[model samples]
Target: MTLPLRILMPLLFWALGLAHAVAAEPSGKVLRVLAWPGYADPEVLQGFSQRTGARVELTVVGSDEAMRQRLLSGRGRDFDVFALNTAELQQYIDQGIARPIELQRVPNTRRQRPRFRELSAIPGLIRRVDGLTQVYGVPYTYSEMGLIYDRRQLSAPPDSLQVLWDPRWRGKVLAYAGGTHNFSLAALALGWQQPFELGERQWAPAVDKLVALRRNVLGFYSLPEESVQLFMRHKVALMYANYGLQQLHLLKAAGVDVGYVIPREGALAWLDCWAISSSTGDPELAHAWINFMLEEPASSLLVSRQGLANTVSDSVASAPQVPLRWLEPVESEERREHYWARIHSGDSPSRVLQR
Candidate 1:
């Protein structure tokens, strides 16, 4: 239960007064930030706190599922701001877990590249709520989910998504464990153009493809760090690089001789954005954090240290020049998750289709 402002004010002032001598006095505001690993660096958080006089509390989530669970578990009250991909932003908007961003408060967005400046041009960033169309997310970073292969095992880089299931490399491949994305990847491998929208007829085949993928892979991994550990420990020949260049940078740092490529079918890419939580008590501080992330040092650090492309600057790293299928809202996220669980749990194809 929230205390009345009259009582809360006196308590807050008393607490801050007691600590002012030992620590730099803060503005009595705290900004809670929940984001993926590497998105909020220590230096960046320190800079934001120092500049704004707001205390920062950060939480790092590794997978999309984990992020969703956190946001929903607390009804968006756990954090004031969060980062999620464009593909996943719509559900939050529809559920009212995310609130419309006040762009006027986030002035740094003006410094973003032209493509990101016009939020409406990109899909899933806005929606009409009660006759009012409002913007909900701001683009921050992006990357393509390409394939990473070991140069020592394959003479040349594999050109297609089908290579993930090649019998010859059975038990030598590492794939992502996400449900919706794995289903979409399976759709692509089956030569379906609309990977996100699977028809009734497309469901069985996608299930079969995922079952095959489960059988052929060394194992499935959810986080980039876990994937790298599995890849190096198993001497994995090929991997579905769900984390894209970020994974590549980790492996390269560990001196792994690997090559990254976009398959012939095209790679799935995601543009992650920072969004304000609907339950936030301090919307201004949340907006300040979002704008602070767009500064040169923070944006450049993403490219140099995390190997991700920032919205404000051109990346120094080499991203492949190939067609990319940016992720979109899937037809049925729940259906995909239900089936993916059975498939990943070692269920036989016939048994998996029983439902």
Candidate 2:
């Protein structure tokens, strides 16, 4: 039974298309990662891909919130693991997007500093099920969000978070555009011991402080390189280092004469860690990836090149009086985000807090 020429040709093409698509499907396993830029170095990914049979596919994001939103967009099925700050990891845990880590599988974590090895001591890393504890994230790197000032512009280092509000720095200051850190910095300047735990009464004042900072600054920056560019172009006298010492490293490498200060109120610090996705098909491979990153060479790249402190470092900046206020999960993430939006829209202080 010979078919007509036109129908036979169409049927043959459809069968061939299906065969080609199936053949093009990848054979090797893949370890998908959602991480920050430096965490996805080309050489690191290539080496990881070569070491393990699994290919490494990394998606780089700019901020914690950006990473969170990306994970939510895919409903945890997109990446096998994530590199996120501890403060932001909670949302993923709460949403069941992240899974508890098996410490037995990641023995390299034992090489971490004493402080990092005690995950249960930390506020957010542990959970209990039937009286057995589980760990969620593995602390990888950290930095303190401090103040960076041009030594040439000022003779002495600014000692207070209030310096950001100082009218003296008007038109000469650069700030991070994010709402979270800015609000926290405002709360710190207002002497709130728990800056993230802002009460309704404290909200108005914090909004007012942030509005002041917004009005006085030349512009807000998002990236470390953007801060360097802003400093060079606008003669930015002072900057809130959102990327912490990483920004300072970039600025210094660019030949900027800037000094970093912790201020009297202390700097807000962040601890970024590796977390596994609950929906991942290969938990052991994900664990292997985390263990690989904990190797000495990875820490060396972080400390020597990126100016970030890793978990295994012995001589990290740990002075007792440095007063570093590690960032925590805030009282109401939604409220802070809502109010901070108004602050950025050039709203008057009174109207910004009206809601």
lDDT of each: 0.81, 0.76
> Which residue pairs collide, candidate 1?
none
Residue 10 lDDT in model 2?
17
TM-score of each candidate?
0.79, 0.81
* lDDT computed for candidate 1: 0.81
Provide the lowest-lDDT 10-residue window in model 2: 1-10
Model 2, 1-355: lDDT tens per residue? 0001101111233322221111112447788888765654555666666677677776656545566677899988988998887777888899999999998999998899887887876667878979999899998887778889999999998888778878988999998877777778888788888877877788888888888899888989876777789999999899988777787777888898989877778778878889999999999899999998998567777777667778887534443376666667777767777877888888898888775
Instruction: Report the number of the highest-lDDT candidate.
Output: 1
Number of colliding residue pairs in each model: 0, 0
lDDT by residue for model 1 over 1-355, one digit each (tens)?
A: 0001101111233322121111224688888887766676667877887888888877765456767888888889988999888887887888889999988999999889877787776778888879987889999988778899999999998999999999999999999888988988998888888888999988888898999999999999877778889999999999998878888888998999999888888888788899999999999899999999999678987877777788997554434455556688888888888899999999987878777
Which lDDT value does model 1 have at 16?
A: 28
